[model samples]
Target: MGEILLPLLILCPLAASMIVSVSAGRMGACAIGTVACTGVGISAVISIILSITLLSGPPAGVLQVTLWPWMHIAGFSADIAFMLDRVSMVMILVVTIVGLLIHVYAAGYMRDDPGIARFFGCMTLFVAAMLVLVLASDLLCLFIGWEGVGLCSYLLIGFWYNDPANTAAARKAFYMTRMGDVALLCGLLLLATATGSLRIGAVLAAVTNGQLAPSGVNLAALFILVGALAKSAQIPFQTWLPDAMAGPTPTSALIHAATMVTAGIYLIARLHDLFAMATPIMALTAILGTLTLLMGACTALVQSDLKRILAWSTISQLGYMFLALGCGVWQAALFHLMTHAFFKALLFLTAGAVIMRTGHEQDIFRLGGLRHAMPGLSAAFAVGASALAGLPLVTAGFYSKEMILSGVWHVHFGLTREWTLSGHPLWGIALLGAFLTALYIFRCVFIVFCGKKQGTSATGRTSRLMSIPLGCLCFLSLCGGVIEMPDTLPPLHLFSTLLDPKTPLSHADEPIWLVLAGALAPLAGLGVAWVLWGRATPVMHEIPGQAAIIRLARTGWGMDALYDRVFVQPFRLLTWLTHHDVLAHAITATGRLTQAVSGRIFQARTGFLDILSIWGSRGTGWMAYLLGQLDNGRVRWYAAWIAGGLCAGLAMAVLS
Candidate 1:
């Protein structure tokens, strides 16, 4: 039953995608959307049933099914297998349920577009790939889905390929993520070589039992970490994400906000045991995550475009998840990942509605006093913003964020007691990021929805299809974190215990002040936002002659410009220098010389064939004579000659 169901879960959406692709020009938008949604809806139902069965069966319950052998070469093997444990259950639910909602919303969001069929086709295919990524039991098999999402992302991000900027954004995303993919492939090879298998269980067991050298473990972990960083858009690789807003809003919601960007977190958490043994890499992860969190928050604070703000916010939120993983509180990271998906998806979808109705106006400063005109949308946006800001006690973001903060505060990593890395500084930075998160997101909310009407006026009302998903996500954004609470709240470790029964997450002995600090950071940020932009006369437009620091923050601290000068300029220079094909010319010269030499040689070879034939006949006669010497009358010599002839014949047959 599990085997049949597991394959069905992937095949449903995959088959739908194929159908849509093959019948694209012949199908109407409604038919396309219905087919896409129905496929995901069925997968969602299967995921729920699987989740219920896993939870009800046992603490260590897992449903694994191998449909067939994926590959077998020499000493290497992999299987087309699926595994549904607690971690995957959470991921599948997020991928399918959130993915379905986005599809439903996209139906209305893209209703009038001519390429609606293509959009649905890529969207459905993306969901199927994500499902494969989360469910695979073998690392090699997981990579198939890993690359699958990347390809789908490229296609969807460049869906409107007529626009040069859109295609450029797509290419940029592809190239940058490919860098990390290369590193990830190297890491997987290292693990496979050491463990002699790519199965997740075997890899983890080998690492835990000291089958790999210390250096090997660290290098593998480090390589995988680099891949995750690029995928998740951590610092130094984050420029592509903001530009990714060139895609459609639902694309942003599905790929950037909910699923694809979180692939790194999932990969790391899935191999937590391997990471645990590499403490230095763990520290590096935590440090890099902290820097990205702070940088993304600061960059988001000054963005005027609506989607770019959310893009940076997604980067920042993922940093929090990475920080938790680094601190060894993976459950906290996964919890935040779930909640972030809900609110972030809600925000993107709601923003899409606002953009569509307001004549596609994306500049927040140019739009104002929208709450009175679109009360429901304004309300939904507020819910998403509050959850993103972690407004205490009421929002899902607060609980998950609090879990991360608590986990960071108590974490200690080092080679020795005196040289240990403490989490106190990281906790402080995260809190600061929290305040900035509230300030930036609420700043957008206030400037867009709180004051007098200004630039672009509302044009159309949001359709029921888009509104329904908004309402569902709004509810989820506020209530999804109840399954995990802090020490100060009613004790509930449902999320932690469900993920791992042996060591359920707890912050029981921590002081009460930590929770209070986490709760206050966002509240204070909200108060500050109200003072700045939430007034009757809101600060809606960009100020003239902005300070240098303000300009820097707005430009993502000039990281793109720096990268261009440091990397892009040098490469372009090299390309230009080689544009005339000097090496190719040199090779061409050599080829011409060879051609001339061969021409002369051919002219002199008129009788060479006959001479070569005579030499070959003589050589053959000599070899036959030597073989004839083995025909001595002794039975032993004859038997040996026969066996040699048979072995030579068998070798030729096999080779042929």
Candidate 2:
């Protein structure tokens, strides 16, 4: 059952992609969409079934299905295999279920577009690749899927290739992610070389037994961390994501919600053991995650566009997940990953609906009082915002985020033999980030849906296909946290227990005030949001240097400008300066020399052959002339010539 279902989970969507692509010209939009939705729908069903089987049997259970030998050369080996442990089970469920809903919503979202088949084809292929990424038991096999999703993102982001900006955005995403991918590939090679195998279990066991050197472990972990950082859009590499909104909104939801960005978090969480040994790298991970979290929240706070706000929010949420991974709380990171998927997907789909209905308007400032025109959508957006803001115990994000905060609060890093770093400061920064998250997201909500109408009227009602997923996600966003509650609440370790039966996601004993503080931060943010933008004719205040601050945040702290000057400009200048370098000219000169020599050889050969042909033809012409003279005579001449030939033959024979 495991073998059959595991392969089917991936093949379903892959087959749909092939079908949609081949029959795109012949099939109608409805048929293409149905094929796409049904493929992901089946995968979702399979995930649920696998979940039930795994949960009903054992807490520490894993289901593996090896399809075939992927590679085996000398002392190295890998497999084209799938594994469904607690971690991957959660991932698959999120990918398939959320992906299926997104597909259904896209069916309506992109219905009127002419390239429906191409859209669904890429969507299904993306899902399949993500499944392979989550399910792969071999590192090398996982890299295949890693590159697969990258390719799909480029395709989907540039789906509307007629637009130059769209194509440029797609190229940006490709190039930036590829930068990280090259590092990731290098890290995997290092691990494979060290472990002599690319199997996840084998590599982890080797790390656990101290078979690999300490330096090797540190270098490998550092390399992998860089890759994850770039893929997840952490500091220095996050610029591409905000611009990635140039694609259709569904693509945004899929990429931000459950697939491409989360791959980094998943990779780190999956290999927690290897990272645990590299304490410095782990601390670096924490520091970077904290920085990225704050950066994303601040940038999101000032963004006017709806999708870009969500894009930054995703970067921030992923930062929390990475922070947890750094703190040796992999379970908490994964918990947030799951809950984040639900609400983020919901928010993007709802935003798409709003944009579609309101003449494709994305500015929050331009869209106001939508509660009157779109009550259902307004409620949907509010629910998603509350979850994104982690507005206390009512939302799933609160539980997951609380778990991460609690873990952060207890973290103690030993930077040196004489110095130790406390988690309190990191916790404070994270708390501040949490407040900003609530403020920015709720700010969008209040400005777009709560205040007086800004003359932007809803043009059409939300489609049933879109509405259904919204309702389901809304319910999940509010209730999914019940499976894993804080120590202050009822003891529910279902999520942690599923991952490891003996471990209950433990945290050191801390004061109750920490939990209270964590819960209060988001509430404070919400209150401030209401005060600023919740009323009709909201007050707009200006303070000294406020404009400068807003400008900086709005432009993502000028990271893009800095990168352009430092990286892009210099690279462009180099290319322009070396457009025709001396080396290139030298190579061209060598090629010309070879061409000249070959031409001379060819001419000489042609002349010699011509001379031989002329001599041969003249010799044949002389023989023909002699024969013509002989035949010109009468029969007496012919008989005389014959008698002369016979006498000459007899004389020659006697002489011989």
Candidate 3:
């Protein structure tokens, strides 16, 4: 039964989405919601069953299902094949489970909106695309899924296309990711040229057999890294994500927490061996991850909007995953990715509840004293924030983030003798980012739910549908880390061990002192936040010299402006030249050349024609005068003239 359902997992949601679109007008809101939930629910069930089957066997187990030959041209061929490997199995369950929950939440969140059908359709399509991306057996199939999700993101982000801001945001997200997509395609072509394989299994198999050259693998990994970074919204490619909150909160959870943003991590994880083949690329990736982690944490500190804060937090957490991958501890990265998904979804949903309750007010400065108004959701928010802050041993984030920091600590210690040494800057940046993450999150918590309410606010109750998922996610956020216990005492390392201790996992065995520092870092951050903002009211403006600093953080370190001036503006100029300058000038020049040639032809015709006409009239007059003279019939004169004329005519005739 599991085998029968594994292949249809992606299709279930897709089919349901299509049915909803067709029946949207005929169906009521409840019916449409039911259809959407049912489809996702079915896929989630299949994922669980298939996971059980694989988990029951050896961790090496993989379920490969081939639908048909998708393409065959010359030597290059591919199938619509899916692989349920251990890593992909994790992704499948994560996408479906988290995705189904988000869909249910969206049903309640967007209940009153008339465009519910459009939202649900796009949501399910995204779900389908993500599942395919994670499960794809070949680069060709993965690209298909990759493109599908990009399209869906554009549609869903601009779900409220009436607003120009939303449209612009949708365009930003689409075009920004498009740059990485182009690089990704180029990398795929290069990989295919080097190895002549599109199937990931064959590619990895070739790597295992030591068939690929080092330089080619490194180049391929670099280009793919650019795509991953852009898709996952890391560093320079991260500008679009915060703006993407112009979409609804459910969309935020869907894109940021669980599905689209994690694609980069999954891609790197999927091609784990290829990246491992080139250590320099991994180091470079680690550097990017560390810098982005701090960048996000810094910017998140000053953000006023609740969703934007979470958005930046998502960026920071994703950087940790990237850091882990770069350090060659992909198991830690994957664990963090899973745990981050849960808490982030919970946080976003709870924030959505707050916004709904307070008349869609998202500004932390304006919202306050919500601890009493929405006690249930407020408690839920606290759970999520605690998990995100990575405070101590109780939360899921503590274990996962500590795993990443543990890897960083090991790297630092390996480079320098002392564990506390600052020789390796990534270790320092990651730890500091952890502290800032806690401070900023709790700061928002203190300002919103703990401070005084600014004014009269509306009240909207959260439905049981929304409440139930929040409760489940809240429980999971608190306890999910137990899956892989840290080694302060007897630890399980269950998540790491399940991936097998043959390669990277064996070294990731229960990190020691790093967990201790990581544990304290968040506690200190929370303490500072409590002291500073716990009793203080929100301020309207920045303090004199602090304005510049605040502006820098608010502008995401001016990355957007830099990209605009560097890439977007330059590209726009080139486009303008093509349409309005270069192309037009070429056509205008061709016309001028034709006109010049015509003017020379006109000169040759008209000027010489006038001269010839004058000469022709003069010659006719001379002939008439000679004819008149010949007719005069003067005896002697006529005889002499006639003889002269005959001699001249005979001489001319002979010469001729």
Give me the candidate number with maximum lDDT.
1
lDDT of 1 by residue, 251-335 (tens): 9999999999999999999999999999999999999999999999988888889999999999999999999999999999999
lDDT of 2: 0.89
Model 1 ranges off by over 4 Å: 538-545, 574-579, 582-656
Q: Report the C-alpha lDDT of model 3 over 1-656, residue by residue, as the tens digit.
A: 65568778988999989998887778778888999999999999999999888889775888888889987877577888888878888888889998988888888988889989888988998999999999999988999999999898899889999999999999999999999999999988887776677899888777667777877888889999999998999987999999999898999998867789999999998898998887778888898999999989988988888999999999999999999998877899999999998999999999998898888888888987888888998899999999999988789999888778777766632222443223257888899998999999999888888887778474968899899889888988999988886666456778887765455343345456666788899999998888777766443222133678778889788888898898889999999897777978889999999999999999999999999999999999999998997788679988897899999999999999
Report, for every candidate in turn, its global Cα lDDT versus the true structure. Answer: 0.93, 0.89, 0.86
Candidate 3 — which pairs collide? Answer: none
Models 1 onward score TM values of: 0.88, 0.88, 0.87
Tell me the tens digit of each residue's lDDT in model 2 across 533-607: 886656642212368887888888888899889878998888876895867888899999999999999999999
Model 3 residue 51 lDDT?
86
Which has the greatest TM-score? 1
- Once fitted onto the true fold, the runs of candidate 3 whose alpha carbons sit more than 4 angstroms away are 412-423, 456-458, 501-512, 536-547, 573-582, 589-656
